[model samples]
Target chain A: MSAKPYNLTYPQLGNYDIPIGFLVRKGLGLAYTSPPPMTKQTIELGAKHSPDYVCAPFKCMMGCYIEAMEKGANVIIQTGGTCRLGYYGELHEQILKDLGYDFKIMNLTLAQYGGIMGILGGIKKYAPKRKWSQIAKVIPTVAKMIKSIDKVEDYMRKNMGFEDIPGSFEKIYKHFLSKLRQAETTKDVEELYHLTMRSFSRLPVHKPDDPVRVGIIGEYFTIMDPFSNHEIEKKIAMMGAEVHRWMDLSHSVLSCPDDNALDMLRSYAKYDLKRFPSSIWVDSQRKKIKKYVSEDMGASSVATIAMADHYAASGFDGLVHVKSFGCTPEMDAIPVLHNISADYKIPILYLSYDTQSSDTGIETRAEAFYDMISMRKEARQS
Target chain B: MKKAYLGIDIGSISTKGVIIDEEHNILASVYLWTEGNPLGASKKVIQELASQIDLDEWTVVAAGTTGSARKLVGAMCNASIVKNEITAHAVGTTTLHPDVRTILEIGGQDSKIICVEDGVAVDYAMNTLCAAGTGSFLTSQARRLGVDVEEFGKIALGSKNPTPIAARCTVFAESDLVHKIQMGHKKEDIIAGLCNAVANNYLNNIGKGKKILPPIVFQGGVSKNEGVVRAFADSLGEEIIVDENGHLMGCYGAAILAHGSGIEKPFSFDVADMEFVTREVICENCPNHCEIICVYRDGELIDSWGNRCERGVIRS
Candidate 1:
């Protein structure tokens, strides 16, 4: 007999929700509720229950869980990360239970579960009657799907600022997301990725002969999630500059060198990199980064500094570092980033978001930063 | 006829304005206390600037605005460029002093330092959550000391031996100043010490990690104080260039940017007489309950903001 139909939901981390929901519904035979897109109410609800000092993401997650629970989601799937988010499962579970919401926590603690397959085993346990072969094939497909979703968005970032039509990029992007949700198999997803790329390239663009390229390196959650960072990557692109961001769900899930040939990642670095501070260092700076920050600074924290160093040496005009307020890993990584910024002589703009500051403040800073780099680039060329 | 561009910087403590010609030369300038009403202060500034310029001989082709209430006043004046004070200050300073590498700006409510490389600001740091070393702090201290804040620089200049005051925070500085006064320290010495404290606090916080170099341009309301300028000079071991029009730099920069943007929308001085109204609306269409702000010009809606999503978009 088939197991009871499980109602599941996951936190909003950018538009990855499209692929993630498909993985649950089509891959695992579970019904998923896309909790109302995280709004002011969602954050407020989460902030009310969360501890005063926990990072914004934790509270945001709490709010998402509560909203999903109210909408009849019986199980919550949480993709754990390197920092405090790993332990958020236990605390969030207790908070929800205290509020009397019946749900199962599919907290994929990658370390404790013994890598990706072990987490798959945890998911398999929920539907023991299902055939193992079918579920096993779906795991890699889900990973490929996420990689594909990130790949198309990656290309979109570079040229969205130069779209001939003002809202062309967003229109194509929203359409791609809906098409991605309708994708049934790994083959279908792979086709969608290429098709999306060709469509983006065909769009009318008016890029300058030499565009200003900026690297965005920061905390994983804030960088990946647009709502938290005020759609920063998009905003930067809209300012008539190309943005290169390395942190995303695909990079985190599949490890460095996104198994999918992401053209954007190729120029970033050229090495087989593990999660930790593997040898993906920019040329002639391996020794400095090793000495700049030691191990135990966390993976992304280590990667952020390395990326900054790499992007700086690669002649990028500027770097933007975005982090959620009270993010421990980024807090440790900031000073190191400053040193790299100074040493490389590349301008870096630091943005810390806690949900209270107005969007105009961020926009002003971004506009100023854009002008700085754009001016610097023109001056150098002259 | 020479086309003129107008720029206004409406800060929490003061409203500053400048009307510049096509050459970026300041033709008309005015500074007025905001008195907690930005709209009213901006109107007064417009009237003052309008009177200074021959309206019949010149036309304000475009306008720009900067500072805390840049958007509010930008809407009021139909600004073509609405930029931040940091960028405006950098642009304004660099235009006047091209070789300047460091800019230390302390305004009424906040302090920020911009490090320039090749006439473009590369890095900047603002006092994120501090109010210790700012104009308002010094003004409050001056009020407590029973001295006109305008005379603080002259008095501080007379003191050779400055008293030491703990100015890491306002509360600590207030108590320390009281104690120093009780200890029979001369008034000028204490005033001089307050200047030193302001400079020290700024360098320690906003200027931390920033390489302070020569050709430093100091602009803002705080830069008007000779005592603070001397304090900065002594601390950095370099002369501080305090522009005579430093108070109008933000607005000056805004005006320059408006001219550079090449978007010439005619600005009429009659905005000072026109009625602008704003109202707040609680959007309850969803659970978000976003507080939407609607701007009206002559009883018709012009703009609305504060919604997070398209659902909150007002049909004005």
Candidate 2:
């Protein structure tokens, strides 16, 4: 008799599901259930179950998992991060168990720490017949898919304001993303990427001789997800400005292993000085942030400020720093952002997002910020 | 015929309207309480302003709207421009006081600070989330202190040693004020302390890290309070320039924006009595369930909003 097929689901974060769904279906040969698009009810459900002041992303993810469970998702998968997000899988399992959800959890963070061999072993449990060579072959292909996806999106970000037709770019972009979903092989994805790029290039773009350039840097999840920050990038682009976004799944998650290699070496030198001296573990990210902040401000604090400093020096007209409300790491980055803004003579707008329904206040502030930057740009040109 | 421009500022607490000509001369102005009905208050404001001006000699060719309800009133008045309070206030103040560098405005429910450079607003912050040290905070405390809010400012100036109150939460400040009263602090001192607390709170929150350069021109509903003005001057160590027409700046700025929009549309005073209606409908197309709000004039739907996706949008 055939064993039960593993039906898995992961929390929705921007366009990440496309890659994740591919991974589960093609690599593990298992079912990948797509979590429903986030809505008011999703937020409400998440907020109701989550601890007060536990940060917005946590609650939002909780709501996503619960919805996935309802749709026959028997295995919930989540990635780990250095922030509070690292322990989300454990806490979420406990909560779902308490809610009487009969499901297994596969946290990829441990696999991430153990490297490719660990990931192959984890997948072998689900696809018991699959060989290690087959799993190893899919990793590079998935990495390429991620890079191609981000490239298409990056092009859209730079050109959203310049579309000749009101929404011609967005119309074509949706078509492109849909086509991307249909690509089943590396050759298919690479060909589609080139084809979409060529198709997008043909669209008329009426970018002015000099348009305002704005860079956005913030919490990884908030910057990447549209629902969390109220589609701020779109709003800024609508004001006839080119937006330069700093985070991508390829860079943040896929490339992070290489990015943190230098950090790991530094932590090894100061090994025993760690808070958990009894354990044989050292936090690499905590040591890397010492370059920006003398002390560890906790969870991705260094990256947030580093982005601010990098963007300001790049001479972007303005910067928008957004984060989930009650996020301690982003809160710690605020003072440093102020110093960066003042030093570089650049303007910055700090937005702390909660589950607030109205976008009126946010719209007003963005419009004003756009006006200020454009006026400054015009004055410089004159 | 002289072409006049109309500007209306519809705040949560009050509705302000002004009519100005090409020479920047205010021909008519009116301020009235919104009373939770912005449309009605705006209509009343229009009626009052229309009565003050000679309609036969001057025709309003362009109109603008500002403040929290700018969009709602802008749709009602067929305004050429709908500006946020920050832009409206900055434009109005700079036009009146060209060399101004900073603007400290405290409205009924919200307060804002605008740091200006070369007559342009460089940065601005609005405290819409908190009400611990706003105009309404002072007003409610005045009622509890048994001193008329309008006259509270004058009485505050009499105190030599002002009492200290927490400048954080409005609830905490209120409780602290009550405690101070029980502790036998003089009424004038307590009032003076309240003014200082408001100024300090603004500086701490809205004006944080912003270079508060002079000449600082203070405006808005709370700028009418001389005691708060004095408190700001003492704290910043700079003289505060309170415009005589401070409260009407939003309306004036809106009028200026309308004139600059370069789109000429003749506005008639008769729109004040026109019937306007709004309805909310839930779209059943998708699971998103977006509630679309549509505005109608004379039973004809003109505009609608509140759809997250394009499938739910009903374009007129």
Candidate 3:
């Protein structure tokens, strides 16, 4: 246990921070401070402290940790993953300590915990004053909040472009998020979710019957975080295309994998003993893209390929494969993406982002891609 | 009076302009270096184009803009359409060569490959996170060799045995070129090798997994280099077509688009005489620090952009 009163913070990943903060404050009985909203300065700070060759997500997280510490957070949490992300916790701790920050790193990767119970116990150690029953009471609300956030965003991505009033959907979305931040119970989240959905539907939209649809699939972190990917989803959606993305906390983590598929996928992992997170989704996705990939390509490659193939087969006009620069797992999936693009005859824009702040290149490419797809659609119809 | 449409492609290294009459016939064209001044370069292009065409006979009704400075130039010209270079090039090339299946473009600092099917672009890829295998690289290498960039093609054609240079990155290729120079390789051979390196790098990077079928059209500033053309031909084992007006294709397409758009925003050569200026204001409202660009004409703000939020809006 930390000697100081626990004030917790985690790296930002889109709006997922809201639910995480809810959990830490309500469930764990610890003071939770949401990391400062990401900006150019955050990225610059992160990049300055990070190793030159490390993936961009590491740099982003590093920046968040420093800012959170400066904002009075003494406990930082880092999660484990299958890729280099699995080792980020230790490195972040070492680096932060070297920088002379007095903080406790609740490195989940180093915790001798296995699955659901393990995660609970690991977090329980910091909230010694709070009973397990009290913590258990808040889990449902946290889960509901995550699902509601994803649901609202999915609708926004699909319909934001077509709204009659330019910023109508965005205004509602912002309101929902602000209201969500103040919600205290499951009923509050449920009511806010229903009200937001209703408001979204009531907004006047000029959607076409056969609108241009673009699917986005890529590395988990970069794909989810709008800041990291330069708000690509919003950019494309605003360009009058319906954007669909299947990789999210709800799909990848909240949903349980089938036990049978878990057994099959475990053998594919080098260490068969570790609990397979989201194995069912990966296994199902792997099955769909079996011809393109023979086995697991590691990290989120399976989800990326499977979602891409799904989008292509379902008659999507375009696909965007986004990844941070020097991301090996996503890089390995490029050959498979190429094959899918060929087989489906769908155009895929490969966007690899580094720490460079200039968005001109991204805008140019995205505009061109939108033009090409919309023109192709017109030609097909004519 | 004959009605014409104007198009301008203001790129990083060069600015090209074209005026086309009905039926997409080129009435006048101009090409010049941007020299880090898009506004100045575009003004000069317009002036040169105006000099070539008789304003008394033909009235330019609509204008379009393309390339990196499309928005800036578009706003300045009151353009009917401002399209990206990829689509503009594809449309222009496909209009000229209806059967063209591939369009290869290597501009000053960027390169892209657009795959066409039935006269429409179906797939495309641009060089990402790198400016390698582009025209500016070749120009720099030409300067280092103490040779005019325009003479590179003819000199490369003279080399029987081209020295092999690294094709992966600009830095690697530079070091390799220096090493071969120290190793006593001939200038012509090294130049030829650099041309080949560009073609190979383009193929390995932008052209990766893209189908480069027949009726391929190679255009852009670099396309004028016969060495790169030859190199592309050799690497792909396919005949590459370079049009006489390939460099003007972006502007030509823009003109076509403006004409097709049916929205007439009267274009006048008087824009060349107008004082247009742009100022960059770094918004200190928040941490994003968006560099909002405000465009002015005769010292009055006309259009402003680059602000991501309402807080950064610059009111004139």
Question: Top model by TM-score, which number?
Answer: 3
- Return the clash pairs for model 3, or none: none
Q: TM-score for all predictions?
A: 0.89, 0.92, 0.96
Query: Model 2's CAPRI class?
Result: medium
RMSD of each: 4.3, 4.0, 2.4
Residue A337: error of model 1 in Å? 2.0
Native contacts retained by candidate 3:
0.86
Q: By TM-score, how accurate is candidate 1?
A: 0.89
Q: What is the DockQ score of candidate 2, to 2 decimals? A: 0.53
lDDT of 1 by residue, B139-196 (tens): 9989999999999998999999999888688789889999999999999999999999
Candidate 1 residue lDDT tens string, A1-382: 1234678899887887777787777667778998778888888899999898888888888988898878878889876655777778889988888887778888777554775568768888776667777666677768877888788788888999999998887887887888877888888878888888878888999999889999999887788888888888888889999999887776654554423446326624543222322323222233347868656466468668878987898988889998888788888888888798889888888888875535777887788888888877877889
| lDDT tens digits, residue span A1-382, model 3 | 3577889999999999999999999888889888899899999999888899999999999999999999999999988677888889988988989899999878776344665567667878898789989988999999999999999999999999898999999999999999999999999999999999999999999999999999999998999999999999999999999999998998887663434756645634422223234454676677767788888877888888888998999999999999999989899999989999999999999999989898888998999999999999999999
Cα-based lDDT at residue B30, candidate 2: 96
* Residue runs of model 3 more than 4 Å from their true location after superposition: A1-3, A110-118, A256-277
lDDT per residue as tens, model 2, A1-382: 1245779998888877888888888887789898898887788888888888888898889889999889878888876666777778788888888888888888766524365457546657777887767766777668878888888888888898888788887887788778878878889888888988898899998888767998888786888888888899999998899998757776554443324657545444443311212111224333443445676565556666766777788788899888898778788888887888788888888888887767888898898888888877776778
lDDT, candidate 1, at B206: 79
